[model samples]
Target chain A: MVRVTELTNLAVDLVDVHKTYRKTVQALRGVNVQVRRGEIFGLLGPNGAGKSTLVKIMMTVVRPDKLVGTILGRPLGNRKKLALIGYLPENHRFPPYLTGEELLDYYGALAKVPKAMRRRRAAELLEWVAMSKWAKTCVGEYSKGMMQRLGLVQALLNDPQLLVLDEPTDGLDPAGRRAVRELLLRLRSEGKTIFLNSHLLSELEMVCDRVSILVNGLVARQGTLRELTEHTVEYRITTTGDLAAVKEAVERCGARIDNTVIILNGHNVAKVNELIDLLRGKGVLIESVVPHRFSLEEVFMETLGTAR
Target chain B: MQFCALIVDSLRHALDRKLFWILVAITVLVTLMMLSIGFEGGKVSLFFGLVEAEVDSYDPLAASGKARLVGVVIYGLMDFFLGWVGITLVIIATAGLFPAMMESGVIDVVLSKPISRPVLFLYKYLASMVFVLIQAVLFVGFTFLVMGLRWGVWVPGYLLCIPLLVLLFSYVYCVSVLVAVLTRSTLAVILISLGAWVVFSGVRQAPAIFDTFPELQKHHVTHQVVRAVSWIPPKTADVTYLAAKWSNAGTSLDIIPASAMEDVSAAERGQLERSNQWEKEQLEISAFSSIGSSLLFEVFVVLLAMWKFTRMDF
Candidate 1:
């Protein structure tokens, strides 16, 4: 029953994953991550933060030195379970000689997708990615954005339950990125799990239901957007009147003054109320008071700084 | 299905290269050259009768002349051209397959598939042999048709060159894959595999070289070591002789025109006899030992390479 629940609830549950390259460079160290089923889960990290390495371990492209978890309800590296997973690696290379259709058919076949189904999926996916017109064109002639789009199509050829994409928007223009973003959301709506590893925090923030920020081979933070940013709330007060009159009073209230705005850190409603009362009593004309949440980039940078 | 996909993909890759067409063109030219030579009654005609030579004792209709023709096809075309030059060209064309497959962006997607790394490695190794297989089929198949239809001299055994050439190539290609998997460098694969081929041939011929010197042959210890070491590498030099022997092309000396040897001095004739004896001795090696031992070596190298591939971080 526990196994059944895990199988239904989590698409990926990795624990104590460790990987050291050439006996020295520790790409991952005691990293634990859990991705719920049917959600777009973003894995954010700076370069060398082991985000790609962790994804590689999950996809069985790179072996982990130590790991204890289940992927799609089976032990990690399960070949049969791999059939249910689709992976679009960063900077994926398709055979230059093969046309777009052939590349899909070839990788689909490797994933053990049957011929008829591969053909059908290839057609549907090419249309979905707006690549049907270029189906017959050789991959060598494709632009980088086209290659990235084709890579996404190839990953979905098997109609995998779990989609792991590393840098899916690496070379895409804004329009292409938006299309991919929408496609990712559509896949999630259809109950497919997406484990995205990328440096594009804004992209992930728009689509991901939850995210894990990896730093120096560890998960610095892992939670939903609200859960991660809830603690980082701040209230900014904009006033038409000069705040030099009540600057000392605002500082005494643990709020800092920056230009005409008073910045109050934390989610303390009473402290914000007290600051507002003091500003009003001083006859300062309050323009607006807004509670602001930290963006994913700020969270990522903070996590990175904390990890460092 | 995955294995079939790999093979088909390999075929497509081979077709993508200019070398494949160049090889096909070479085969066509060789076939045309073979077509230009005509056998008439008791004489030989070269280049559509542009040159003719009288054979007073050699009759094209005789059994001996037919055997000579078969010998020339086996030893000259199959053994020398396909076995040496064709194999080298195919090697250069295919030595990059594994390394290319292992390229950073390429390997990640491939290795993430449902297939096991060892199986993928082995399938890829076999797929590379498809290049040699296609070349051998074309070269031998075309020559066989030309010999049967044009010359009316059919030796069905000559068809064995197809598989024989593939086997010969496998002996060297196994080393090429091992190097490619280890280094993932195309240049390293090409250079080391070609170097290994030369070393394989040299080692296989060491025992024969020892027999030429009475002093070395008399040392039982050194002779035993040389003989034992010679059995270790794939017997690449023995493949041509095996093809000639298996195809029943007769001895290498049987292909010599009797008219041409008439004016040779006694000393030269003796040297020719000695060389013929050496060729005969090479042919006398048992087919089982030659092929079996060579296959064993190939299996070892392939398994070693597969182990490296399976255990690799890629």
Candidate 2:
């Protein structure tokens, strides 16, 4: 039997959560995920892969047909637990007639922040999002990137324990994306759990401590990047001497040498050491050795396959 | 606090709309026009010459009462027009209120907060009602001022009708909201609401038409028929012949004697018994039923809107 106590301390735990729209389109097909506290967990998927649907279900914007989940150690859609979660939807829009400050204040009030604190936090968030200069400007005139920044600011207004962001960086520039990345990292460091749905694999690789790859409305693979991508060890060796000898030495150590590259399949670090030792003993002067880490994108493609 | 935010936001939104300003301008212009027309008192002729026929159906006794009735009819027309305008505006305004927010993905941000759905819906409904009340008061108060200026009397009872007018407008507004929840397009909501307006307006007139039908259907022996043949269309000759027969007894075939007509003056004989009291009661009943039914309709519309909104996908 699964230990339920493990989820007692978890930020989010979903067991057999299913959401079917009109009982036809299965947006989420029995998705089960566990996010530990104080980690930036990325939920990566392609278009129509149910990324936004899952985020919406978690945020209670869309109710699931069957949800056996706990958010912030409480049942899903619990009001008290909802207060502990902040959500920024994809392509977030605010009332165009309201100024940036007014929009933030409005959402802050809805989040039940103290009246005194609302003003202070609104100002602070506007500054944090680099929108202090345009705080008085109506959102109707704001650019898409500015809206994204403001969206993030509003999501962080309640100082929530878990921040659920759906494609939060969709319209941001490189600099804006960087700011969001830094913000997420800072929040994680401060012991806040972040659930991010992003299409940018590079951003996810840099920020996410753990990730779940969703394909066809189900979890294809889920683990830390180290756990998922550490299966293969690839080393590029440049040697000055005859490369034929180096190739033979690597092959003898049960390593495959393909075009001056030595690849050790699986976690066989010993073979790498043996190849290195053999090259040295054989008087094969190696110029440099470089190790290539598998990117999250590569791992995602590998696990999900190139069917798309 | 959230409710307050919703109210403030809704007011700000309504204030910013260009349609709202247009409505204000129209109301002001209409009030001024009514004031001018009311001040320039003239005899109201119910029938105008058509097809080279001079038909004058003008009442001269206590012309002020007739003028006041004319003014009241004008006010009713204005109220009906305002209802139409208000319904259109509310439909267009609220059509985007929820669906647009959801389409733009802002609902996720708002709904994910700690606020409950019922609280949010309540605030929105309250905000809409407040908006309707403000517009109704502004329009009706201005019209009252104009009427009081010309008539030299301000009826407080008319002011009491403001709530009824607001309730009527709310019925349309809430029904528009329900359409908004059921449809995805603003144009669809507006079209549906306009269709509803036509139906309700026609329904409200049904009782009056039915009440007058039998009396209007009464046959009469006209003087032309008495001179030539004895047949006249019952629909066309009833009210006129009845009034004439009641005025002069010798004009009919079954005339009592010329001496009977000589006893009473034409004006004295033309007046009907307790006509004013009966007319007042009819007006009161019609007004009461219209206001009560409209208020109940608004409540039902609001409940339906809430149910649909709660179950909607976005």
Q: Provide candidate 1's TM-score on chain A.
A: 0.96
Q: In model 2, how well does chain A match by TM-score?
A: 0.90
Alpha-carbon runs more than 4 Å astray in model 2: A1-7, A243-253, A277-283, A306-308, B34-61, B64-74, B85-95, B149-151, B207-210, B214-282, B286-297
Q: Over the stretch B1-314, how does candidate 2's per-residue lDDT look in tens digits?
A: 88888888888778777777776787787776665543223432322211132223332223235334534433443344454565566556555555564554878787898877767777887776666667767876886676567656564545544565455555566656777777756777778766766666554434333233334324333322332221111111111222222222112222223344466776543332223332333333433443454566667777887877666655
Computed on alpha carbons, the lDDT of every model, listed in order, comes to 0.88, 0.69
Q: How well is candidate 2 docked (DockQ)?
A: 0.66
Q: Chain A TM-scores, all candidates?
A: 0.96, 0.90
DockQ of 1: 0.83
Interface RMSD of each: 0.8, 1.2
lDDT of 2 at A306: 48
TM-scores for every candidate against the unseen true structure: 0.95, 0.81
